[model samples]
Target chain A: MVSAAGGGRVLADQDVCVGAGQCARVAPGVFDQADDGLVVLLVRDVPAGEVDAVLDAVDRCPSGAVRLGAPAGGPY
Target chain B: MTTTDPGAATAQPGPQDDVPDFPVPRSCPFSPPQTYAGVRERDALTRVRVHGGKHAWLVARFEDVRTALAHPGASSDARNPAFPALGAGEQQVAAELRPFIRMDPPDHTQVRRMLVGEFTLRRVQALRPEIEAVCAEQVEHLLSRPQPADLVADYANRVSTTVICRLLGVPMEDLEFFRRVTSVSGSRTATAQEVGAALQELFGLLDRLIDLKAVTPGDDLVSRLVNGPLARGEITRTSLLSQIGITLNAGHETSRNAIPLAALDLLRHPDQLDLLRADPSLWPDAVDELLRHLSVADVITLRVATQDIALSVGTIPAGDAFIALLAGANHDPAVFDEPERLDVRRAQRHHVAFGHGVHQCVGQNLGRVELEIALRTLLERVPSLRLAVPESELPMRGASAIFGLDEVPVTW
Candidate 1:
């Protein structure tokens, strides 16, 4: 069910997004948060080196809304 | 899935009475508690006893710690009946305030939004020149004072205290009173009642300040809140008070300790200092690395599981409490290679030092900017700075949630 979009997916599940901004903090180039504090995608084709930080963001997200549907190297 | 009553949540899956203390003692100042490292090696999450014999799972490994904090089932509201209190009477204070720190979702987002713009990188950048000026003034004060200046008092305290006071709109004359009153709550040895009383005193002071801001709005944070959210009926007066109180606590404490901690670490590793001095661009990255390397006073924000969830290591049933041990996570070997050695050129940007998720420190951007400016100014102004006393002899702060120093005696 979790698959990549384009080269990879930067998924922010709307309901689960709590907007703790961990995603934005970890990979600001790839993620951002709205005023209501929900994670927003800045860029979907996440760069290669930033993948670990992106995963770190998805993992640390207070609400667990983020996911690597199609991580650059492989599936998360 | 097992379920328990709120109070029974304190009795989570664990050996009833045999884990090491919550603020695990460190063998040396820079090292993570030996127990924490042990836990990280054994399991991603382990239950341990906190200050008041409260049992909560300790999420140690980097991935698991992040999983625990960001879990949908996890809740930070200490009032959540199930949430674990760090110490005696902590629940009372936490629940009473129900500040944004304790609130879940919508309320947390809403309350935090009211103050977010003030701390964004852009905002903190705009405030940098002023912070630099303050840091310069404090450095001058350190230079002028008697030899072997207490860096904690002359530099760290003066810089952070003055900057925060100005940001919060405290009158210059009242800064000493507010600073002294605010620190009473950070006392680890103090009883919960004593800390509560101190917080109440802070609330009262904030109340008067809020009232003044209400009548005559100023450029300060409290004034902005009074005129924006409170006046708009978006947030209650009590919520505003809690926000201000928590801000006052976090604003000064993180930097007050961090500036000194980073300085101490840099002094100990003069080679790293030389690297940073050679290339000033390394300051921001170095600051981030230090924040990760130094977990000043633990910031494992406790959360109660609202439902059963498999936490990689174990399944935490509904109503059990757990904390995201940033101190432990920062050093997880899986995340940061060779987590120990102080390398200023290190480039890992993501750290839970200011915390993560919607509940991350609101003032983190400000904290970072302050550190960057203050440290840069200090190194530039006082190139010969060194510890005045033996590092071992320097007194560390007592058992407080946020670890800090009593005095950082140093000299140029």
Candidate 2:
């Protein structure tokens, strides 16, 4: 389970999110739920310290809404 | 219940050779159905006979189950006629009511969106104190009871009923009415007419309550919906009624079953209970583990393929009904190492017990909060809580849509 330590972005697609709120619960620092229960990315860039949390959020997202994007330079 | 055409089963994905029953009952009461393991071992989708002897594809593997649920070709619309219903009555009633749970988007999306704000993480977190208070009050009631109290009837049922009622602004005096409603409507043996009658009364009650809420809105979900979606004309009064009905039912049913069953599971494994008792912080993860292990609401994830959808394992042809067994997915050996054993610290959180895709349980946040509080309060307040009867003697509900214990007789 490699942490998202390589500079990468956290992408939350509202279209795909079913609003299960796993992201907000598992990684409150990086994700939050909008009023409509859709995922709201609090921070676009994953912080070094929050990498593991972000990874967990990605893994736990039921609808595949939350994902770890490629390193900053690569295609998102 | 109509039997499937003999040739139809052969036309499906799996072999024409011997199709076992659809909802293979759990032999151990607490474990997944015995047939699932054999079904999962096969490469093709295993067709099984449902309530009506109708053929349905059983998606029994973890990855395949997820794929089936999340697949765009899959349809939850009950009107499809092929939608798998363990109860003969459910398909007709659900098709008539058109609850969002049985509808595909954008209809499902629109209805669900209007209600999601009410159950957001922030909102549920705010409701924690009230949930905790409810659990604490139930504890007092349980403690006052004589020896060998039924936790299912005495505590779990009451806590779930009160919490859902309060959330929906339903008067407590009518709690027993709801018990009847759920019982009649949830029964697999109930005829279509009986289920319709039960829901008719339910709708009537909500309709009257909606009128009252419109006049004098409160801080509850019913009032919020009455003042917002219904008032705005974005949703019809009829649609609003069914939405609230489904919400109220879904809100409580899962928790009512999960709590005592989880308690029983923990009690059965004293080592797991001791671990949680040692570190109360493990309660949240432990709750998740319990939900995954129990997977009580396994059968509710029923669907029909609107179009042929190919997965890595196999394809579900169009118009074919399928049931994504949540228990099968939860107990998958590939994802969950030693799936049967209860390990509270198991880091897995992607269980389909709340289900998958857009139709996932909306009240799940609130559900988690209530379960955590209810179990923690019970464990803390009654340290000596143990089964009053032998574990083998407890009655497990095998006929209903939700898996649960009929009564958990306990004495501390």
Candidate 3:
């Protein structure tokens, strides 16, 4: 199942999930903790500018649990 | 555990008798006055006469030990002539396991660099929420159980083993198998046959995992290591296997012991538990203090002197073997104030529980995060957690390199 991180942006299991909680700990405004203490995405469509923090979160997942999906309007 | 000196009492004073005089910390088990009377009475670093070999110098001072650990003159290679066990057959085994933590600068640096990316602070912090959730779920289950549960078996060991398994990308179904292997490997008297069997099983498992990642790579560390720069021939398969084995061995056993040991310590001092619960911010510092008070790995990695070196304690001749006692150093009166007293709030920035220098534990940050999550979750979930048996009756010392309870039975 997928969840949102912030700005209503969707995060699938492979995207925005590094298994680390830099998002939950540092950017709690956009992330919430699941019962298992893992960060659950709370926003599904974040703006482009917010991508930096999300990427930082991605950089931190020890297991590399995060991936950024191409935006819909990107060059085919 | 006593041995008489053969040549010391009869012949003229030799190099063995001229042992250095490093002040042994009072925290050493050997330092207790009633435990080993004659040995404790001498200077901390006094040379002990051995029946089979010459007298060997002991480095008891913390700074001296750290220096020895980092010095080029001190070799992790067991082949040195002065190493106490040279007469025995410890060289071959030591040679095999000493690569990352035992070797001198250039070699140690190279091996460590290869694995350093896996343990970066950023990488470790990413596992926080997962680790926290695991701890919370485990503690919740423990809390729901009937009174008088085996905390060590039910909680600590499971939590540690699970985290380590996840980190290594070991199949969930295979965890029990690996846990069994790890438990046997860490036993005090594991026979050669048993160790051989365990290694075979572990290597078999790793081989399968490597193959699985090759075909269907996952986001786990193993897959990254296999398919990333390491896979392009930057690091050898044997080296990766060795690094994986070391990580698993260290990550599992150390955390397994630390969780229960810290639990027992808190249960023994309810006030500290209350203090921690009252203020969750104390969790990080509490973990450090727990590590110091219960310093899990009692003995630091062994170092053999490659050349003669003089220190504040005394002179250590070339090619001698010495053990750095992390437990002793943590409790050294000079380093810690009121060393024996357990203060969860103590500002303990430096503790040798995780050795020092190039060989210092790579996974220590992960370890600290694991401990913090486990302790905080336990406190929040099991408010009344207390020892089921008397403190004295609890088994505190294990037969392995790590010291912890055989089992911690507790009641809410």
Whole-model Cα lDDT per candidate?
A: 0.74, 0.84, 0.61
Residue B397 local lDDT, model 3:
47
The TM-score values for the models, in the order shown, are 0.86, 0.94, 0.73
Best DockQ among the predictions, by candidate number: 2
The collision pairs in model 1 are A3-A69, A4-A70, A19-A37, A20-B357, A20-B358, A61-B70, A62-B70, B297-B402, B297-B403
Candidate 3 per-residue C-alpha lDDT over A5-74 given as tens digits, one digit per residue, 9 for 90 to 100: 3333435352323233434544454555453234466665555456555654443333334445544443
Could you tell me the lDDT of residue B373 within candidate 1? 87
TM-score of chain B of each: 0.93, 0.95, 0.84
Local error of candidate 2 at B126, Å?
Answer: 1.2
In model 2, what is the error at residue A23, expressed in angstroms? 1.0
After superposition, which runs of candidate 3 have C-alpha atoms over 4 Å from their true positions? A1-76, B1-44, B48-56, B78-94, B97-99, B144-146, B191-193
Candidate 1 residues lying further than 4 Å off, grouped into runs, are A1-76, B1-16
What is the DockQ for all candidates, taken in turn? 0.25, 0.71, 0.02
Can you write out model 3's per-residue Cα lDDT over B88-158, one digit (the tens) per residue?
Answer: 22344335545355456566556655555565456777888889888887887687767788887778877
Given candidate 2, what's the lDDT at residue B177? 72
Which scores better on lDDT, 1 or 3? 1
**Tens-digit lDDT track of model 1 for B1-412:** 1223333344543554566556666666776777777777774356666666767777788877777766667788877766766656667777877877888877786777777766655456678889989998989989998988887778887788788878878665644554575466665456668877888878887889888998998888888889888999998888888888888777887788889888888888989998998898888889888888887745548888887757666667777788777888989888888999877776665778877666777787688889888888888999999988877887776565677777888878
